[model samples]
Target: MAIKYGRPIELREISRRDGATASPALDLTVRPRRNRKAEWARRMVRENVLTTDDLIWPLFLIDGNGKREQIASMPGVDRLSVDQAVREAERAMKLTIPCIALFPYTDPSLRDEEGTEATNPDNLVCRTVRAIKKEFPDLGILCDVALDPFTSHGHDGLIADGKILNDETVAVLVRQALVQAEAGCDIIAPSDMMDGRVAAIREGLDRTGLLDVQIMAYAAKYASAFYGPFRDAIGSAKTLTGDKRTYQMDSANSDEALREVELDISEGADMVMVKPGMPYLDVVRRVKDTFAMPTFAYQVSGEYAMIAAAAGNGWLDGDRAMMESLLAFKRAGADGVLSYFAPKAAEQLKAQG
Candidate 1:
């Protein structure tokens, strides 16, 4: 039967019916909200969990004394001096954070067309690594092997006639890796997207008797605008006049990330990373499923600033959002996350435990 315009279409037939009509029935059998109604139930059924050990704090090191220059774009992040950086590493150790990633804010005067400063033994990053390891011997130090921080043109490699030289850049990266390894870095992460860099760096580390150092390749870094805050933090924003789309992958592609991961894994990378994590969880999942290697996600600076800004404006609950974001990484199969919120998130998790 059907009803329309305040009248039933089978009204006449219904009126002519002699037998008793059965009543309509409505069934409501399952209630999924029952489990959600209780906090304990929610906790028990939570599939993905984020912990302090899953966090790797990224810190910026600059040459100075007792100075912590605040990066305005990244609200809570600052460029710390060597001593200040050591103190932060010590605090991270106290909070049970397993590692700290280092990016140097090289002096502009030290920048070169070839990024030669990157291979220097006394560069900002190399010095910072040695100092931190000396102060906190047990804490893991992950060094970025890219030359952008030390390059004046803001490209990640040596430039010739306005084009990035891939092989030449790999040669420089090999030396850079050796220098960082010599400085006692536990991991040499190559964020540069140069061809054959992973294999080159592996051989270089081996030749230098640093076979124990790990290689975490940034396998799938996209040309994302989300990295503006990071560039600003490293003082490279002003220098990067053009885009890096020539080297970085397009954000529209997902399957290409898998290919990139395969290439890096085959090139002797012990681990692979997917940058701008939230925007590419599919990429992360595909890489993890394909390689089954140690995959890390970088929760870039802009993501952190967005949450902090929203929370500061009373538009959202900061703590809940923070936990949810980190848990999302774990849910996406990230072995760990490099986040600016590592300290705060670790504190919250410790308190919850």
Candidate 2:
């Protein structure tokens, strides 16, 4: 029988009704906190454990020797020269970081309307890849196959009559992939978001006899404000004329992300990525569930800066927040993450073990 309450019932009154001395008014048979009562218990029941293997350190490259130019917006992150980049790659390898993604901060003189320098074999990115491979041959090197860093207008594709051309840009992207592959890039990540580029790049790679090289397409890259710090890091913030809303996915749509991922997969992308990770974890989960393919996420620059800023102001514990953020990616079913926090997080994990 349900007891209807007109007023609050005392524990003693309930005890009297039950014919007991002092029975409690409320009882919980399941105590969810029991599993969290001890560290050992929590560890044993942890659904996801982040490790060094899940990290891919994204490094910025420039031209020089022993140079490490820091990006103001992204604290603790720097653009390194070829020699410095190789040393950074060696450090990542020592930490057991499986890979490092390279994005070049191309000089202004190299920037042009067609982004022709992207195809140059001795370009900053290609030279960095060659140097890193020479020293750390086993370390996986992911090269960003985009024109934004090389383009004067900072657009990922060619601009024609105030519009970004898709098909024409893809033709150039194919050449860019071939150049990176020729430089021994382990993965050619086309972050351009141009339609049909993956199939074109895959074909280009195959014809060039670079079959072993992989393509990790940025399938669900969104035009979000989260990319601001990244633009600053790559020195593209100043040159960008207009937004990339025409090509990049809208932040409002989730279904569209699925379609993008599906198309990329069908077009021969060996792996797919969701950019600006934390905000789109749902997209990540959905893509992983739908395809069961190798899925990765970029913990983009803005996300790192926010955490760092808060920590610097003493509002949050930096180390704890960093670990939690990375682990959240694992819990959301990310196979791996491209993070600026990679080296620091890896060191923390190593220290913990």
Candidate 3:
């Protein structure tokens, strides 16, 4: 509707005589857009900032000599042997990356139904941790304390009669944490999503006098289809015969994620992470706001692959897209991001700086 003053109106004036009492003020006082006019101005007004310091590189370790195996699903990502992994960690150290997360590609021969190899002090994961610490003692080492990578069945925990046993899984996880801690891991990230695992790990660590190790819980990991590429990278795709919906959080629930985070925090998680970063920015924001802890987001395999595939086809600029995607995590209030593109992104950021 149009009013007499030429302004569109949603409500009608009850009486024409009432116009006398109504005064129109046309003061050009506020100009908020002016501050957003220039690059420097926009930067000054920016609410959230992202930096190279906010990145944590995730590396895959394998058992071999002079190996650099490429993961086809995850472009530009490779699985390196322990020596090569240490060299990559050295590069990250020079680039000033605060941390590096290690995920081992367990050989099929080593994986068992119970994932008992996970508790071995000289397992692939523990050996990699020890090697990284020996070479780069000052650098942060985050180990994934989950059994999927080591389990023949490819479930995060022990499965019996078509169901996951929570209490039984926590017991093994405690032993897994102790082994990782003994191998000089700085942080133990329990990505299994098993109930009471964090508390079990905490108690296990304390009893063993490894109380200094930190726990970064994958508190709200969902059973999303986005993990297909990751499964391919870790060679677990063929082993996982069924879905993880019984244990992992449902993709449809947002409030439930907050409750899960709360429980992990109470159970002694030093930090919490929300998986599949791009799809769950809202979850990241909510968790950061609600807990006010060192919240992190995982720029999972699918997020990495999509950008790379598009860039490879000349549909998008790879470097620009990579930086933009990383910056989004920072804008969403992530203290750190676990990304496969960390090295590439960090190199570019260093060059730009």
Candidate 4:
């Protein structure tokens, strides 16, 4: 029931029931509902707005030509080959999406304990970067600089004696960042959660004549339970050895997230990201308000799968949920969001305009 619009009808009914010519109204000076009485008024007073400029679409890549495989876990999302990925980039540009993030699904045959496949010059990521940049040179391409997609153990860092080696992993991450930036990537996002890696990657790029490349550190990545479907989409669900609690931040600690973000910023990161977006929005707000950097949030694969599954079951409207979820990030003070629903949301925004 529209509160403001229904109040007048209720007053008329009361006046007739009391046998009086006029209704006795309760005096009210400040009615909050006045601004929400109509859609135009609501738009005029909206505090935050979601638009195509605030969206970053994540695209998954696979090895092959002219192939497209739908991820069972992520309903509408697909694992496209280089050609199909280029076509998708074209679509993103047409929709006015400012950027597209790339995540590769490395095959098992190329997997190794050392994650050596990550540094291969002709790997799936490097090749896809070349293919997309060739046709759509103006489109911004962001590449994830993590080895979990290329590792046999499905861990982001190198492991030894049942423990993650931080400094050793940073060394490899530097090489990975270099290859992606060299292949026409505009942003190198390190999601490995390694200490001091952001500084090392920045120095590595500066030394290699790649000073123009930007770094978006996954500063506050937490080891939450919401990443299961993401592992499945990348084929890491079956290969993961154990939990990554030792490296990823604990969900119970918000102050620790601030320390992590502070360290990354001091280490020379151009931007910062909060992963598993909605659940960690407090951290997003804190990071944005505190550092004022280009703060971003990622709507993980598990979050997408849950909403998609519920929508498929006819429980709620998928479009509204997607838009509301993304808007929540914006209202929480995120500069942009990396979402699986980017293309759909962009289309919706265009229609509304």
Which pairs of residues clash in candidate 1, taking residues 3 or more apart in a chain or in different chains?
none
Which RMSD values do the candidates have, in order? 7.1, 5.0, 7.2, 3.0
The sequence of per-residue lDDT tens digits that candidate 2 reaches over residues 16-41 is 44544434355767868779978999
Please, what are the lDDT tens digits per residue for candidate 4 over residues 1-353? Answer: 32333575445444444535443354567889889989999989999999999999999999999999999989999999999999999999999999999999999999898889899888999999999999999999999988899999999989999999999999999999998998899999999899999999999999999989999999999997888978887899999998989999999988898899999999999999999898999999998999899999999988999899999999999999999999999999999999999999999999998
Measured on C-alpha atoms, candidate 2 has an lDDT of: 0.92
lDDT of 1 at 286: 85
- Poorest 10 consecutive residues by lDDT, candidate 4: 1-10
What count of clashes does model 2 give? 0
Misplaced by over 4 Å in model 2 are: 1-25
The whole-model C-alpha lDDT of candidate 1 against the native structure comes to 0.88
Give per-residue CA lDDT, model 3, range 1-353, as digits (tens).
23545664336454656754655343346868679879999989888766778999999889997899999999899999999998999999998999999998999999998999999999988888888898899999999988999899999999889888999999999999899999999999999999999999999999999989999999999999888888987889998978999899999999999999999999999999999799999999999999999999999999999999999999999999998889999989899999989988888888978
TM-score against native, each model: 0.91, 0.93, 0.91, 0.95
**Model 1 segments more than 4 A misplaced:** 1-26
**Better candidate number, 1 or 2, judged by TM-score:** 2
- Indicate the TM-score of model 2: 0.93
C-alpha lDDT of residue 323 in model 1: 87
Q: Rank the candidates by TM-score, best first.
A: 4, 2, 1, 3
lDDT (CA) per prediction: 0.88, 0.92, 0.91, 0.91
